[model samples]
Each structure stands twice: as C-alpha cells, then as structure tokens.
Target: MEKSPDAFRTISEAAEELDVPQHVLRFWETRFSQIKPMKRAGGRRYYRPADVELLKGIRSLLYREGYTIRGVQKILKEDGASYVAGVGRGEIEPRKREGEMASAPPPGMSKPAPRVKGAKGEAAPAAEAPAQPLLPLGEVRVVVNRLSENHADMLRAALRDLGDARRILDPSQGR
Candidate 1:
C-alpha cells in the first residue's frame, strides 16, 4: 500500500524520494540546522513533509544549482526554511551569483535594490531580497540562460581588451 503525500516518511523512504543516499540525509541534518526529523526509539528517523521539502530544496541548491554548502546555509539563514521549501516545489527561483548581471533591463522596467535590516534596525542596501519576486522554474531557467549568455559575452569582451593591452605592452608578442 502507498502512503498519502502528507504522510511522514522514514529515512529510507525519504532518501529514495529525494534520490539521495540515507547517509547523505544524515549528513545534511548535521550541516543544516533547519532539518529536524522526528526521532523515535533507537534513534529511528521520520521526516515530516516540510522537512522533506526543505531537504529537497537543499539538494537542488547543492547538486542542480551548484551551490556550495555554505551558500545554501547562508540562503537558509537569510530566507528561512519556508523559502527553501518553495524552491523545492519550484515556486521560488534561486538568486544569481555576484558578477552574473543581465545584459539589460527590459524597456520601461527597473528593479530597485533589496533592503536588509541594518545594525540599528534600519533598512539597508542588500544585493538579494524583495527586489525581485519569487519566480517559477520556467522563468528562473529563462533568466539563468540569459545571464549565462551575457556572462559569456562579457568574458569575451574582457579577453579581447586584455589581448589588446598585452599587445600594446609587448608588440613582439602581438597576435
């Protein structure tokens, strides 16, 4: 018999659902304080639906999105578990890394910078926050692809500039 979607899952079941090893789940619990599976006798683990969702998000960030453990941890700390769970459900998009700028803003549209709480409780400038709405996976993919293309263009331009500078410095080495 199959359990309902809302049912709590054992470690094995959760691991299978997440397509990760049981040991990986255990290791995640150590790295991410947000993952608190209920403990039964002999330390058997049962994962609540939310816990599983959070784990799925962490896995997506680490594996699919290529985020370092520290990056995921920082996301969880700033955005909270619910936000990560949204990411797992494909309801929220991961933010871009530094230096991955979009080529240009759409006409007649501009995004204000996100703000964070300052040391004295005032709103201060922060790179990622409410500046952008949580986007679905399709939109996120579109944005990511555009960023990647633009980043490649930027790198090519930078390389060209470097080559020109090198030629100016050493005419004998010019290509």
Candidate 2:
C-alpha cells in the first residue's frame, strides 16, 4: 500500500502516483507558485499532501477538462485554493439553474462503455458483439525477430567501420 503524500513522497513517487513527469511538476511549481514542496539537501523534492492534491487538480483541469497551462495558471491565480479545497473535500457539485440537471449525450452518440475482461483474459465487449481477436503472438514474434536481425546487421557494419578507423589512427597495425 502506498503512503499518503502527507508522509512526504519523493518527486518520482509523486510523479508516478499523479501520472505526470517530474519535470512537469517542476514546471507547475514555477507556474502555480502554490505547489511549494520541501526541498532537502542536494535539492531532492518531497511533496506534501496539499501539493499532491494541487497536482491532481491541475491534472484534472489540464487533461480531463482540456484547460491550457496558462488557463490553469489563471484559474489558480483566481480561485485555485478554494477549488482545490472543494475538490479535496468532495464538495464540488455542478452548479445548474433551478430544476435543471446536467445534459446527457444525444441519442446514438453515447460514450463507449468500458471493455470487460473474459475468463480467458481476452477483452469482451461490455455490450454488443465481442471484438475480433488481435493478430496472433507468433506473427508478432516473427516481425520482432526480423527487426532485431536488421538492427544487429546495422550495428555490426557500424562496428566494423569503427575498427577500420581505429586501425588507421594507430598506423602501427598495417591495413
């Protein structure tokens, strides 16, 4: 089980949990100015719970809601703290006009359902017909083997050229 960020996670751990890169988190720190994680000796970053939550909000805004980095920065500058708190506390609700609920997708244009795995470890459709089986493993293996052979041949040719150059440079070994 993974510990919460309140216990302080290394930058890599935070990035892994948040599904973002360490450089991205560093960039966000520069942009948002609210994600100040603790930097230890040798400049190792350790993220707190608040920082982790802020990262989650930023990710949701960027990836899920499709907000640009600048747009997210502006949102953070305006109401980021409160929004983060609200989302963390699960107090975020869609604000609709009286008696109006969020609209559903139009008929025949619904989002695809998640595929469920069958007992044989194959993906079965949630509804409707099962998807066609993918290309056989044997076919994929043959393709990979061919590619590997080509790569090995190229490497060998390059190495031979390097050896020739070395022999030329060290003239004592006659060509």
Q: Candidate 2's C-alpha lDDT? A: 0.66
Question: Model 1 over residues 13-74: C-alpha lDDT tens digits?
Answer: 99999999999999999999999999999999999999999998998888767677998899
Task: After superposing candidate 1 on the true structure, give the runs of residues whose Cα lies further than 4 Å from its correct spot.
Answer: 99-175
Q: Which structure among the candidates has the greatest lDDT?
A: 1
RMSD to native, candidate 1: 18.7
lDDT of 2 by residue, 1-175 (tens): 9684358889999899889888998988888878899999999998887778778877766665445687667777777666854554456631222211114332344556456667788986567566667543222212223234655555566556666776688667666
Angstrom error at residue 25, model 2: 0.9
**RMSD to the hidden true structure, all candidates:** 18.7, 18.7
For model 2, what is the error of residue 9's alpha carbon versus the real structure, in angstroms, after optimal superposition? Answer: 1.0
Q: Estimate each model's TM-score.
A: 0.57, 0.49
- Model 2: how far residue 17 lies from native, Å: 0.8
Residue pairs in steric clash, candidate 1? none
Candidate 2 error regions (>4 Å): 88-90, 93-175
